[model samples]
Target: MANQSKIKVCVAGATGWAGSELAKAIAVSGELELVAAISRQHAGKSLNEVLDIAGTKIPVFATIEEALTVPCDVLVEYTKPGVAKHHILTAIAKGVNVVVGTSGLSDEDYEEIGIKAAAHQQSVLAVGNFAISVVLLNKFAEMAARYMSNWEIIDYASAGKIDAPSGSARELAYRLSQVKKQELQVSMEHTQGVKETRGADINGTRVHSLRLPGFVISLEAIFGMPDEKLTLKHEAGNSSKPYVTGAFLAIKKVGSFTGLKRGLDSVID
Candidate 1:
């Protein structure tokens, strides 16, 4: 109800590829305020000066700790996986809800963060990718897994992305595992050639991660049955715009719950 009653938000990695776009959108939203930004490269400068966006004099801090001093209602974590967990925990420790837009966070990281969020009575909504198409892909794929006896996931991302088997792939694998067990793959001991070629087994699903130059981010689920097969795919272009709306959605819904929830599907109706 303060500062024109906008939902105050702090964006970490506010100058990065996706974060910058999300921050710009937040600046123009009447219901949200871009209160503080965290970007080490643009530290000590006002977001208005760094991003050249008018009407936003938000300060850019080098660390989440410095940024959280502004007392935001939500902390949007868009930084790298290495520092993302720390930033999220820092915000939760301050009793602020979090919407995670970062990637490459391991399963262990989410477990640790979930515990911290619960102890602080805070909520953390971590979405692998905010693209609406990608969100729907998980749902559609889950349905396919229920009927198909065999399936595999192929995850593609830019070569610079260090995470193997991306968050999207992990999410799909987890969902399919919940529906049924993977009962169709050959045993590693009985494999003919190299067993490593089978791709990493993720919760009963074979998940293969490809790091190539042309891909921004893409995911495909291939389902197979007798004399028939189906493939579901989702791809994103070079722009980060597809992610803003969903990240904004997370900011709106994170305060509605406590502890960690993966994907927008968890909170979306």
Candidate 2:
């Protein structure tokens, strides 16, 4: 791609584990340019000092407001839920497209963001899990939902992760809900066990979340029939490479959309 066609990107959580990886990815990509790196903790530092990327001189900003002033075409946010929501809305208001990798946003949250993006005629692509395999896992789970009525979700993450029922699990539940209703052995209201023991009831699917020290990010969709069971699972490694490619894809395609687009599948096509 030519320099004029290169997409200018600002990374919101630029000093974070995932955010730093995204910054490096954009810095080295021919189709993208790293315009600003935003992190409150590392504000006023050069990208080289913050991210350790040699030879690059991108300045770090303390907040999205300061970063947006640099004229960016896209904002890729990998911050916490509260911060990510604010950054996304602000980016849209400025007519800058967004690619969201941060999880924990509810479906209703995305709906409101969609309205804002549409009003500003900007694009926002919000994805729970950006690994291509995870996208396929959700697709396969949706297909299984049509044939199998009984299913549950399991989301696994490190103990440090803040969100419960991981965003991937929530997105999976929503997708499965759209395809078919889960078969219930008993009504949730009349269940014998403690209400909390039933896990989270997300769109009729029981989603169980597990947070432990030894786990990275993983999700499983287990489908059960009269005499058979099928489990679809995807596990991430220690690296963030799995998410980088998908993020880049979103950055490249987000400008084509005018409202919020959920899931990597939207951009996959």
Candidate 3:
């Protein structure tokens, strides 16, 4: 595979919504080669039978353990948080770089992944949300945090989504924390009403999560100065189309670095 023009890739959630779209994209890409796929339910079947993409008969494995048997340069993880961390660690241990599309992983999860990736000299790019609009939202929030230090985050997602503070919101909080520590004029402990309404503290930024119907995913960073207020926000529709471009961009760049990196903006600059 050395000196190959196309990068070899294995998709963990090949049969999933976003993953299926990415798998189809890879099938026709001249720059990428889909060597294997991981789909617990679709295992033992070929990609053509599952995704209906012509000319792609790649084997679908039930697990990453089976997928990595065939050599590949990168592994794209678009599965759940419970299993996502394990897949990422296993890929890194097997000497495969990774691009993480799944969310719900905490700061601690990233710390462990970072140590492992750096030790193995493998790259791992963790993207909470891959929508280009979300990328811009985080960037705009980071810029806002530099001066206006009184901003809080509001995370919104579907009612069925188990993870509170969607990845986009968590990533936004992290990027803003890097710029500066948010200033809290009134601490949560001294609140007149229930302190729980004030939101959770994420690296010094107050974060509120909203789980309800009719929302795919949305994030808002509201920054307030003495005289003015600035709100930067991003929203996603039911379609997963917005995620494809940035994800493909991540796959193309994940191998350029050698350790765990969070957010698409980290690789963009």
Model 1: per-residue Cα lDDT over 1-269, one tens digit each: 35678889999999999999999999999879999999999999999887788995899999888998898999999888789989999999998999988887877888999999999999999898899998999888889888888999999999998878887888788778888886765776788998888899888788999999889899999999989999999999989999998988999999999999998999987
Q: Which stretch of 10 consecutive residues in model 2 shows the poorest summed lDDT?
A: 48-57
Return the TM-score for candidate 2, rounded to 2 decimals: 0.97
TM-score of each: 0.96, 0.97, 0.96
Output the TM-score of candidate 1: 0.96
Evaluate residue 238 in candidate 3 and report its C-alpha lDDT on the 0 to 100 scale.
88
Q: Which residue runs does candidate 1 get wrong by more than 4 Å?
A: none
Q: Give all candidate RMSDs, comma-separated.
A: 1.4, 1.2, 1.7
Clashing pairs in 1: none
Residue 244, model 3: Cα distance from true site in angstroms:
1.0
In the predicted model 3, the residue pairs found to clash are none
Error of 2 at 258 (Å): 1.5
Q: Per model, state how many residue pairs clash.
A: 0, 0, 0
